[model samples]
Target: MSSLAKQLTGVVANTRKLLDLCGSLQAENDMLKLEVQSLKVAVDTSIDKNKQLEEKVKALTVARSLDEVEVGEAGINEKILDTKQKINDFVREIDKCIELLK
Candidate 1:
């Protein structure tokens, strides 16, 4: 019957449209998942960098305190050497970070 055929064609068209939408939801979901992963990585990196900076600040504070306290000239020389060592260590860390960026 003509009516029956028209109804079947309409049903088919509607079904195809629904399937296309469901695929949404699928591609959008995939993209969302990738974005979430990227954001997580960024957050983790930020947290790690913050912790490292906090530790460096603590070390610098201790070093500064040492400068304020004296134990004579010998102690002063030792403090200077220790401070130089700390500076060298910081330079090494900076170089490593630069290498990673490259």
Candidate 2:
């Protein structure tokens, strides 16, 4: 029965090694899950920021069209200044988004 005992001991050692490997894998899986959750939050925030930027662009387009149709020499300078301000604001917002990504 010495050979049988040796076989049992070997089996136990292998089982322990397998259990250790499984535990290690479990820890890695948990870390990956947390990372995925964090990335999802980042993606959602980016989507929201992009939507806001899209709305701002739409507003800018509308303002430009209105200026083209209704602007006169009397108000052209004012309209130009307003459009420039809007453009600058849009640029600042884009810069903020870029900074967030970085």
Candidate 3:
């Protein structure tokens, strides 16, 4: 073969290799773009879930505080008064029984 023909053949081979490399790079880029889009959606979903959890926690905290306040303010005082009345009634009954025995 002529020297020029040999050089042309080498150039064609290099061009084909470069074209293959470009095709491979393009495919990889497209795959990466899809992966990025999927990750973004996942992140958005996670953010929404976090917001919902935070709201639930806030509601629960408010409910717990209200429950604590109710117990502190009324429940204990009522129990104590009820117990005092019962004890007074029991003492009166015992006194009546003693008089009857005498």
Every candidate's CA RMSD: 4.2, 6.3, 21.6
TM-score of 2: 0.65
Candidate 3 matches the true fold with a TM-score of 0.65
lDDT of 1: 0.88
lDDT of residue 25 for candidate 2:
100
Query: Which is better, 1 or 3, measured by lDDT?
Result: 1
**Sliding window of 10 residues with minimal summed lDDT for model 2:** 65-74
Q: What is the alpha-carbon lDDT of model 3 when measured against the actual structure?
A: 0.79
Q: Which one wins on lDDT?
A: 1
Residue range with the least summed lDDT across 10 consecutive positions in model 3: 62-71
C-alpha-based local distance difference test score of model 2: 0.86
Candidate 2: where are CA atoms >4 Å away? 71-102
Scanning candidate 1 in windows of ten residues, the lowest lDDT window is 61-70
lDDT at 60, model 2: 71
lDDT of 3 by residue, 7-84 (tens): 999999999999999999999999999999999999999998997897577556545554555356577676566556
Clashes of 1: 0
lDDT of 1 by residue, 1-102 (tens): 999999999999999999999998999999999999999999999999998998789687767867676778888887787777877887898899899999
